[model samples]
Target: MSLFRREDLHSLAAPYALDALEPPERVRFEKHLKGCDRCAAEVRALSEDAVRLAWSAATPAPAALRDRVMAAVRTTPQDPAPQDTARAPARARATQLPPHVWGTQPPPRQRERRRIPLFVPFATATAAAALVVASLFAVQANRTQDELTAERDRSREIAHVLAAPDARASSGRDGRGRTIGVIASATEGSAVVTLGGYGDPSGGRVHQLWLMRPGAQPRSLGLFESDTPLVATGLGTSATSLAVTVEPAGGSPQPTTQPIVQLALKSVGFGE
Candidate 1:
């Protein structure tokens, strides 16, 4: 049961989703997945993303490009054989006698320079191509790992908010017909916000969350896109409500439009 720590097994989700794990690692992760719902969910999400990325990146090679390359190969002249440089000329050989026969040091034999094979250039090109591919793969893997790590952190924060001693949940629809759900915790001074049926906003506008108080100006909780959940913290004691408004692309210091939805954070009783 303790063969692999939870964190270690959790880190394998991306590799498992991509089918990049070795046989043993794959076996371990599969065993871990059965008992770990979070890991299983992550693997499923990553797998779907991987498939989309693969399909999007797959471009068919030009049909004529191969024929043109083959045609060029057929017409290209082969390189001439390299001359044998190891042998000395007959005259030079005749001038130098064996050290034993001449009783003198035979002039130092010319150092033989190694000749590079013609296939070496092709090998080098292949190696360069391989390096480029490897670098691209490394960048992609790092990006995926970063995304997964960020998601895990966000989930942890949301979990903390939901588990707060005095947390309360509320849900309502925005002006644009998107569902906004909020779980606010006075004890934890934070809230977890979730958007349902979220998509790209029209009119080049963005949705912004605000922290509201009775007499003070609304404080921005930052702009958001897509359906990703957001965790808002640092509500302090003065904050009384959470509101979402549609604003310009970069967002406004104050809400330019009316709130699509609002969740009251009055003590422990949160309501739409």
Candidate 2:
């Protein structure tokens, strides 16, 4: 019975292309490759990736490391020659042989057989290294993709708010003349806050946003560090304006400092 199933054979293409399979497995996979177009194509693709990855990651070996390896190679002792079994006395050979002239029996002290060594071609070694680096690249690419997806979703929400029929914008400047603007959409019940030239919040603090009302505790919108635009949702009709205050890092549950910048939302009929 075959040790590998049909589906199992396909998985060997990468290792085979990389010359990482054992001799027996290699022979079986080679037989499968002859009849499997999909496996053949995959092998070709993996081989190509291996080649490209090798060239991209190749670096000259350090002189010190190379010198050390060469020194070890030169100083290493060669293995002693194998014993001459034929030189053994005739009396010993007869005892080790089968009793009958034509019989097949085990010898008393047969030489130990050595396993065929695994040989990795230079190209395949490059492929193995490439596989390691490729895994790392794949992880980074996935993280970058996730970031792009998040940014895209945020942009869509901001666009939705800006395109509302009742959308209106309010702008004001801080004591330092850094501009802060809010576009509130009554229909969408959300606001997009934009900042310009609003350098670091400074003094180990973060810029916090609040929704202020006549007779209510200020509602926290979120925290800001840079000039990145933020979208604040749940803009109820009672909120009169948006305010910015500098608070300790990580921000506070409530406003700790007086407002440095405020943009009245009345223009968008938010408090009405």
Candidate 3:
């Protein structure tokens, strides 16, 4: 049948389980339930939910409730449906009503019991959507973890180089007279530099660091985001100059402005 018709059948599961559907609608849905595994499962679950809700609201009935009900029954005649021929006694109504209501006897339209396996397309679609969301979250978490790990590894390496027994460290004033500090490994070009009192950059500008050897051209380390210390690996061990210049926010191929502070090393020192 059409998809809309199938969805309609699924929609009735809750009302059907609660005995809220009209007799004819109930009969139609029961037929749908026999072949539609999803509807049957849903109806069964809804029925259980209803039972739990009912029990949660349960309390001891008033002691005189049965007597009061009987008195009301004795004085009041039951109203009958206009379509029903004659009202059956309460006990006989069980057999007289259609199977859709009482469900004690087989209805003429469907007598043979048929087994249908449970497979719900809607439930499958929901599960797939959940899996996709979960996969996305897992991938994001892994990427965040990797970024944190890389930062920690960088910090450790910087600490090791600065703590070396043979690591040479020096502090002096730049042309700006702002304090500049340097600690370079004796065996390698591994180094850490600290800068302070160099105010913030103007809009569209960033501070860049560079290393210059005796006769070689100055090499760019990278852009600095903060006045905090920075670590540079694989620098020239013979470098005698360190400089910071204001450049485009992303930095430049060469210095775009005069150095904010330039420290010319007396010696690229420490025992080598």
Give per-model TM-scores.
Answer: 0.43, 0.45, 0.42
Question: Looking at candidate 2, what is the lDDT of residue 264?
Answer: 90
- On lDDT, the stronger of 1 and 3 is 1
lDDT of 3 by residue, 87-203 (tens): 111212221122233343232231111100111122443333222211111112123545545534544555556555556667675443356667677566667776654544879
- 8-88: candidate 2 lDDT, tens digit per residue: 998987786666788888777765755665676577667666677669988998999999999998987543222212212
- Give, for candidate 2, the lowest lDDT window spanning 10 residues: 112-121
Candidate 3 weakest lDDT stretch, 10 residues: 110-119
> Which segments of candidate 3 are over 4 A away from where they belong?
1-151, 174-177, 267-272
Write down the lDDT of every candidate, Cα atoms only.
0.60, 0.61, 0.56
Ranking by lDDT: 2, 1, 3
Candidate No. with top TM-score: 2
Q: 76-138, model 1: which lDDT tens digit per residue?
A: 865322222322222122222111212222323433222222123334433332222111111
Which regions of candidate 2 are displaced past 4 Å?
A: 1-147
Off by over 4 Å in 1: 1-143, 174-177, 270-272
Clashes of each: 0, 0, 0
Error of 1 at 245 (Å): 1.3
**How does model 3 score by TM-score?**
0.42
